[model samples]
Target: MSIDITWGRGDGAASVSTVAELDATLDTISRAHTEHLPYCVTLIAPGRGEFPVMLDICIGHPERSFVYHVAADGSSAWGYQPDLEPGPPFTFDYAGSPTDAWPERTRVTDATARQAARQFLTSGGQRPPALTWETVE
Candidate 1:
């Protein structure tokens, strides 16, 4: 998941804001993923005001990935789910929909995921994989 940024690319191949916290969350959730929790949920931008963020989780239990859109307050909604298919992994409509789905997507790692959250909060409705979420919370 590579996003075209104009301000130049960042080092470590991750453009997120909080690396330590995101890593901690990922580490905590990775353990949960192997446990009974099939969903393997993790906190993307937890405990924020009415800003807006997105959470994408890839679980190994059922072998599926989920995308969620969370608002600034405390509201959340589904973004895109690929139906758990294995045929070349279809590209979900993350941008340019009647609904503001997650238009901006980040890498499927802890650092990138945090960067994605920051982008979502500051996106204000941008392009590609960033239109999946609306202003709910």
Candidate 2:
């Protein structure tokens, strides 16, 4: 069984304001997964001015996944588990009102984000390490 964590920054999205911040976020996630054993973290490089920051985590044993998205506006955060049921895709209208499009993502807090990650891991019979949020510089 393997756990995979992936992260990516948006093109010019302030959600990850600096390269150092991105690296720190990657390090934190990597360290957290180390306790579970045999897990890998992948960082997807972002293009300049990307609109949304993305993070995805997958557990192979029970086969579960969690996806996270932070809007370019920094006004909202989205989390979804795609392995369960079909959900609406996230949308953004760049030409018009960017936030006007979407299936409407649930507003997320730092604690909720951590909780969701922990729950996903635990449901797969994996013990998740303590995870803390790192602010985007």
Candidate 3:
């Protein structure tokens, strides 16, 4: 499956198309956090398929930890606290919602996704850090 993975801290974000790259980026972010540097890493991976799958990782706040999966038919399931062993079961919340759901709701293209993520990183009276981005095929 082709997965578009985007990750970054503060205003800087990058995208990788391979699983290995994703792992390396996550490791780097984790190391920085371990050193007590206040940083937030947001990963947005959108899959192309009949039922498009999307995985988002917001690593910083334990309470904000979640995994969202949406099927081809606009059906979706999500879970919280993914860092925990035996992560919570996925819950469905699209029973009677509009046709346009997540990723779609926010316009899931690379440009828009990156913009939204950067916005989130700098929101709430936070300072914008120098941002760097890279794309891999």
Candidate 4:
């Protein structure tokens, strides 16, 4: 979902003031190469026990594309990621959106991360009966 839509909950966990802080942290936690993984986070929400939700923007767009979902705090965030293409038709639904653009040789990357993000948001997490890791939501 669009982070600008403004999540109605979790306002206290944000410690970073800018997207840089959040992105840098995510970079460290992420095992994917910085070149391949361009998705950087901004705000953060640590759950009491479950994964935290993040609020962030894309490095290039700085507008429409922002992520808001229940993901693990740090780089291990469990969330969705769409195909990120450059120029025109810039929207969160596009940039950061997932596609079949990945390769079959990759083994060390966190392949399931994007799909996880998609499921969580669609289910309206932070509520009861969280989405399962298997279902498509």
- Writing each residue's lDDT as its tens digit, candidate 1 over 30-77 gives 464354332323333333465534354433333234445555555666
The residue-by-residue lDDT of candidate 2 on 1-137, one tens digit each, is 12233432221222333435544554464454443421222222242234432343322212222334333344333354322343234322221223221232323323333454444333331222322222334
Give the per-residue Cα lDDT of candidate 4 at 70: 42
What is the descending TM-score order? 3, 1, 2, 4
How would you encode candidate 4's per-residue C-alpha lDDT over 49-86 as one tens digit per residue? 45555433232222223333444433332222234322
* Model 3, global lDDT: 0.36
Query: If both were scored by lDDT, which would come out higher, candidate 3 or candidate 4?
Result: 3
Candidate maximizing TM-score? 3
Candidates 1 and 2 compared by lDDT, better number: 1
Model 1 alpha-carbon drift over 4 Å, by segment:
1-17, 40-62, 73-76, 81-137
RMSD of 4: 13.0
- Number of clashes in every candidate structure? 22, 5, 2, 10
The estimated TM-scores of all candidates read 0.35, 0.27, 0.37, 0.26
What lDDT score goes with residue 17 in model 4?
A: 32
lDDT of 3 by residue, 31-114 (tens): 555434223233433433565444343343222233333444455543322123332222211222212223212212222223
